[model samples]
Target chain A: MTDFKNLDISTAKECLLKKEFSSLELTEFFIDRIKKSNLNCFITNTFENAIEMAKESDKKISRNREIRDLEGIPIGMKDLFCTKGVRTTAGSKILENFVPFYESTVSNNLISDGAVILGKTNMDEFAMGSANTTSFFGNVINPLKSSEENTKDLVPGGSSGGSASSVAANLCMAATGSDTGGSIRQPASFCGLVGLKPTYGRCSRFGMIAFASSLDQAGPITKTVKDAALMLQSMSSYDEKDSTSSRKPIPQYLDFLNFDIRGKKIGLPTEYKVEGLNSDIVKVWDDTINLFKKNGAEIVNISLPHTSFALPTYYIIAPAEASANLARYDGVKYGFRENSDDLEDMYELTRAKGFGDEVKRRLMIGTYVLSAGYYDAYYLKALKVRQLISDDFKSAFEKCDVILTPTTPNVAFPIGEKQNDPIEMYLNDVLTVPASLAGLPAISVTAGKNSNNLPIGMQVIGRPFDEISILAAGKLIEEYRSFL
Target chain B: MSIDNKTVRKVSKLAKIRINEQEEKKLIEELNNILGWVDELKKVDTEKIEPMLSVFNESMVMRRDEVFSETSDELVLKNAPESKSGFFVVPKVVE
Candidate 1:
């Protein structure tokens, strides 16, 4: 029997095909585990639907029919993705009772491929936070034990925190996470999992709740690089619904595994060594470079000079876009409604009460930046700086095939550590945002654990539509992720 | 760039959200803390770089010259907080 504790997708597929276990049996195991879980990882549970779907898949296996890519795999969908007839909260009270009448393209794709929908996982309210603390459903507790003594409840890094926690805890085979900045990779790092954020337009943004449309893209968080490849193969497709989606055909992602490093150029940027990075993380970062060099990769010292400005520039642009996107959530259309006799008062009351503190803070920041007289100095200036940040990657890619860095400056901290200070919370994404601004494909691989046995992740960033290169590098790093 | 209560109020008004006085006082400090980021962003020279709004650099997607939604108003209004006679019920807009 395969171990239920770490049931990765690759093994699950093999186990099902070999008749070692039925999909119904596997789905029941996950459902039972989720029922006993205390992690607060899911916002809504859908066991009945999952069981029904699993039964249908069993028939196909019994008849020896050609199986689909994600056939019968029970995975968690981050609440940000709209599921038809299922509640999608985007982790906010505003959407507490809102159920989508239609499915998101990615969720539609996942279902079309015969994947069972487990339930919606919790996330940051409107995907605005670095920690899961901002979730209206409450914080998701990291399953990994904090190496530090007296740290009882460590936070799963987020807005993909719940998705990461579920996968890491083995409550599900794998899960989906939407990365606006470091949402997917950070939480994956914190939980000792593999997470990938495909190039900005690789996955369609149609059904995913918009945080910052330009920056948001969904990807798979899993136990192995191969699992992420299998999930991405199903999630990614060109759609007319999302204009930014690329027409570039997705290569069979698994084909890129065992990516040869014999002649690959790995770029190491000096700027990622920012102030206040955890020394343990730096050690892991250095070790990753050495591992690459030993594998016959030519290492190049490159510079992404505009890297420091990426966080602030992201702060400006993302909030500006968020404020605009979230405007549709006023009392009338759907979701929660605050009763007010006056029309204007109803909009204000519903929004004020429905949104959390962090969401309001971002909306305020967004409104302030885009208001009259501040447009050129803040909003437009941010756009120009964004271009410079994007250009830095263009030039860096000209010299190298991939770039490597630490996913987070530190391992997962106990929840409530940075909750009060928004700037500190914002600083968590400093390393990951530059790649987002450039629309490059980046993946985080669990390299090793720190003194507290908390996980540390190494990031591999690839050029535009070049997910294969990073997946290849990630697979290599996964093999022998030596750390001090 | 430390924001005052007046500007915070104005911005909140623009965003159409309400805030209490205590929340207002805390927002001032929080917004000021974030100003440091913008201050750093100002140091960079991006005078010649063109502003980028979209990343794919693709032209606008020509919408299919066909009707998208036809006879689906009932389904669209399924989640509305209040609706009547095939239209969303809203409070009086004009005095």
Candidate 2:
């Protein structure tokens, strides 16, 4: 039996190249684990498709043909991305049986690069909630159990909960994730994985089920920073299908991993140190600063004063866009339909029955903000605050190469703990939302473990399109902390 | 910023989503709570700030005016809940 737990993407690629293990064997190993796993990480599994793809990869290797970057690597796709002929639920009951006829650009890119599709991992319905509990498929249980109380179950932080959980548990070598506010980073923080939300427009959103169009970005949630870079390289490309896709040349991100950050200016935003941050997390942050300082990096204090408004602004903008985007899921089109006597009744019934509580709540909030009477008071005002938040990062980046902060206020909380209170749940993304609002590239890497043995993650925020700098900085943290 | 049941009903109607009496009451409370928190945005001074429509300042990309490949009707209606000969079947909106 292969030790799948210890294998990372880079090492797995080398072993496959050396003929030590065929891609089919690797695929079957992961597929068997997925079938027996108790964690509800996947919403839909494509084991048959995975086996076929792996077989093809083995044939290519046998023929001595050049292999692609992600060739034969088993990876999880967040259920949000539309996979042609496979069920793409987006963790919503509305899309429970929705099978896309076409593939999302990111998934298509992965397939073209020879990556095998392991399965579609679960997520917050329509990527709305901070915790994965809102998923119609059921909440993804964090594999990191509490050391203090074994009976207490931890939630894999969400809305990218399943992606982070799968990577943390070694269910897959890596997985893809989407971040609107803090979907990728927060979950990565909770699960002790490296999750990167690249600069907006870096990856095409052509077939990603829309959440907040402007804020939504596809990124990688992986076991290591190097794997993230490798996956991201294949996932990113300019697409005409998505109008917002950037035409900027995608850099070979793996090449940037070797560069030293001896004199890199690291910023510490004081505003991020909110009132209720756990003291243990603070200790971890301080320890990370010392590690960077030892590496000859300069730490500078900075202020993103408008940070307080990011959460409020995100709530307004994300839902507003969601309200418009999700309007397409009426009974006449794809997805769940509730039969009714009238057209209007059918529309109402289908949406009501199809959406979950969080999705409905967001839809209503979005509708209210964009309504005739409150547009200026709520939605328009949010757009202005959005500008201020983006400008704050713009100025801060002038003095720093990368900004360092704790990814979440604390480690993973027990499932159902914060599910009822939306306000309490929104606070989980307080440190992460600013970067999303600014459309900057940011990554969350495991810093250390807390007293309960739950992993703590620190975020490294970089300038737009400057993912290399943050990746380099993240690698430093990973290396230094592994030795500790 | 207080949301009442009437407002919830009105918003649900606008959103084309049905809510029962119980759900409406719950929604009213949840909406009010969320709106009250979001009302803090009104406190920020934005006298001269332009509303940011997108993070990227780039204009909409223009493609050459040309016909793309046509999608088959079967593929187009593959996921539709109700479909007829090359068209979706919906409740009659026309009188």
| Span of 10 residues, lowest total lDDT, candidate 1 chain A | A1-10
For residues B24-82, write the lDDT of model 2, one tens digit per residue.
98888888899999999988999999999998766777898999764688988888988
True-vs-predicted CA distance for residue A350, candidate 1, Å: 0.6
Pairs that collide in candidate 2 are: none
- Give the per-residue lDDT of model 1 (tens digit) for A216-263: 999999999999999999999999989988888889999886568778
Interface RMSD of 2: 0.9
- Model 2 chain A worst lDDT window (10 residues): A144-153
Q: How many angstroms is residue A131 displaced in model 2 relative to the true structure, after the best TM-score fit? A: 1.5
Write down the RMSD of all candidates, one decimal each.
1.3, 1.0
Record all residue pairs in model 1 with backbone atoms less than 3 Å apart, i.e. clashing.
Answer: A147-A452
Q: Fnat per model, in the order given? A: 0.80, 0.87
DockQ-based CAPRI category assigned to the predicted complex of candidate 2: high
How many clashes would you count in candidate 2?
0
TM-score per candidate for chain A alone: 0.98, 0.99
Give candidate 1's TM-score. Answer: 0.98
